[model samples]
Target: MIKIVVDLLGADKPQTELVLGAIRAISENKDLYVYLMGRKAELEDFLANVTYDESQLEIVDCTQEITNYDDPVDAYHDKTDSSLIKGLKMCRMNEDIGGFVTCGATGVVLISSILILGKLNATRPALSVVLNGRNDKPFCIVDCGANIDCKADRFVDFARLGVAYMKTLGIENPTVATLSNGIEAGKGSDVIKEAHELLEKCGFNFTGNIEGKEVLDGNADVVVCDGFAGNVLLKSIEGTAKVVFDDIRRAAAGASDTQKAQLEAFIGRLEPKFDYNNEGGAILLGVKKPVVKGHGAATDKTVYNTVKIAYGLAKNNLVEKISEEFEKK
Candidate 1:
């Protein structure tokens, strides 16, 4: 069975929907088990009336909650009983537990995971997200937020992790492209220039430099950059998606019922491409185990999909395979 740890404190209310989603996940996946990490009393009271197999859903009480205000370092040492820390510790110590799902503070989780579980095939763990490409295929971006001030060599490590990550999803020979101001090999800053040389000559299937506009054109499966740039790119893409989608909703508001129906159908097709809920969340690639960073404002649907992602990752044994692949080298 592929075991997953799902943090229950991300939701705003009494966690009714979150608990329901957890129950649904286990009920659907026969061999799946979820470790719901939260307060001892909270979960007890929460799950008391809920209909679910107690055996299938285990609770690990972690009362202290980590907030964005909490310093990563302080929270790491002080908030040992916090759900974020406890969950990471669980994934680190238990081999049966293959993945962790959390919508907690990104800084705290990333720092704690690296300190507790250590790195797999990377210098420091990176935030990796699979974005839907224009051609309907998904591409990955390593170092989306973790490790902001990365070195040229760190970008190389990101490339390696990105390649193995895509391969795990059954994509062989995934293309690698360095994001630059221009498509020319000599385009970007000194760091990009140096990294470009290393990627081209360092046994990677490098497709040369790619401009910003070409990123969504599906020219590459992995667009590598420093965390600063990568994170900016990610937020921009997210904002654009929200604007575009929200605009569609506004346009449909005053339309006729027929037009609204047509728009809804079209939106249903477009949601899988732009919805964070459908995509689950970003993965902390290069960690010792599977760790997913869920959106803070996630709904029950989003929570279910994120946990499903963890289950899928564990079932596929991707983290173990990546660790073995790095060890062989």
Candidate 2:
């Protein structure tokens, strides 16, 4: 059985949401075991409202709840009983535990995972967000919000990690590209230019420089960038999708019945391909164990999908594969 530690008190929604999600996951997989960590009484109260098999779910008592405003590093130092910290400790204590999933502050989750679990090799753990492409393939953008300033070597490591993830997801030779202003070889800032050069010689299937406009054009399998640039690009894509959909809705509001139907269909077809919440926040790669940092406002469905992702990572031995790649380097 696979044991997963969940931060039951982490989300902004009612505790019932987490409870329902856990119950749903448990019902889906009979062999999966859940160790729900949070205040005992609150968890128990939530449990009282649901009817689930007692054998599949177990509650781990933790009194303190990590708030959104709390500094991540400070919370790790001060709140020893914080659910996020406690969940990581639980994973460390038990070799049987396969992964840890948390729908809390991203900063706190990253700090706690590093502090408790440490890095897999000498490489720093990076936050990798999966972006959906046009060809039904998901490309990973490393350092999505982790290390803002990165060196060429770090970007190379991100390539290896991204390739490993692609393999785990059944993509054999994932194409890599460096994000830049133009597709030309010498088109980016000093950092990107250096990264592009290094990637060309790195023995991976690199496709050269990719511009922001062509990110979702299915041109590259993995797009590498510094956290600052990656974050800006991610936000821009999401923001543009929102604006386009909002305008579509407004235009459809005053259309004739037939035109409104067509507009609605178009809007439905153009909706953002990737659901960030549905896939959890992002995977913290280059760690010894699988750790997922979920969005603070994630709903129960998002939390459940994160658990599935963690399970897949553990089952595929993703971190171990990354270790092997680093050793080869």
Candidate 3:
């Protein structure tokens, strides 16, 4: 069975909601086993009301919860028993455990992952997520929100991480591109220029620079950037998608019967494709194990998809492939 550790606390949503997501996952995949880590009473009370395979689930007792307000460094030492810390420990100690899932504060999760599981072959971990391009093909964005200040070499590292990730998804020899303001090779800052040169020589199907507007045009299989810029781009795209959909919904509400039916059908066809909840969370790559981080405001659907993605990562040997790629350096 593919075993996974899920930290049920520290999210903006209620613990019971995440628990329901996990149960949903277990119900669909019988070969999977989940170790749900959170308050024992709450877990037990919630599970008592649900119908699931008791043999496939385990409740880990955790007394403390890590909050966004806690100092990440201090919480590392103090909140050892918290769900976030304990879940990392479980991943580090057990070889059978495939991966971990959490909706904790990003800072604390980063710190604990480094301090506990450590880095693989001295490479820093990058947050990577696969987003669909205009042609409906998927492309990966590395360092979505992990490293705010990155060196030019870190861009190369993110590319390598993205390559490993895409390969795991069954895309062989994925093309890589550096995100820049303009498409020309010399259009970006010093970091982009240096990274672009390095990517060309470092190999792995390095394409030329890609502008922000071209990101979703299926121009490249992997787009690499620093966390600061990547985070802004990600949120902007998400906000824009939400606003556009809301406007469509509002228009549909006031439209004539025929127009409303057409608009509603149009939305029904496209809305799920852009829904963040269905995408689950971004995978933290370059670490010792796969760690998926979901949004703080995640709901039951988010957790269910996150668990499924985490399971795929573990089953596909994502961490081992990443380690092999870095070890070649």
Best by lDDT: 3
lDDT tens per residue, model 3, 1-329? 99999999999988898899999999999998999999989889988989999999999999999999999999989998999999999999998998899988989998898888888767888888788879688888888888888888998889888888888888888999999999889979898899888888886698889988888787888899998888887777777888999887886786799888887787767765565546788888888888888888888888888899889888888887787667656
Q: Against the hidden reference, what TM-scores do the models get? A: 0.92, 0.93, 0.96
Worst 10 residues of 2 by lDDT: 270-279
At residue 266, candidate 3 shows an lDDT of: 72
Local distance difference test values of all predictions, in order: 0.80, 0.81, 0.86
Give the per-residue lDDT digits (tens) of candidate 1, residues 105-158.
Answer: 788878888998888865577888888878688888887888778678787888
Give me the runs in candidate 2 sitting further than 4 Å from their true place. Answer: 256-266, 269-272
Better of 2 and 3 by lDDT: 3
TM-score pick, better of 1 and 3: 3
* Weakest 10 consecutive residues of candidate 1 by summed lDDT: 10-19
Could you report the Cα RMSD, in angstroms, for every candidate shown? 2.1, 2.0, 1.5
How many clashes (backbone N, Cα, C below 3 Å) per candidate?
A: 0, 0, 0
- For candidate 2, write residues 1-329 as lDDT tens digits: 87888887767876568667777887887877888877778778877878788898788888788878889889999888878888898898898888888888888888888989888877888888777877666788877878899988888988888888777787888999999999999899998999998998988899999998998786877888888898888778778877878887886787799998887776676564555765566888887678877777878877787777777787777877787667767
| lDDT score for candidate 1 against the true structure | 0.80
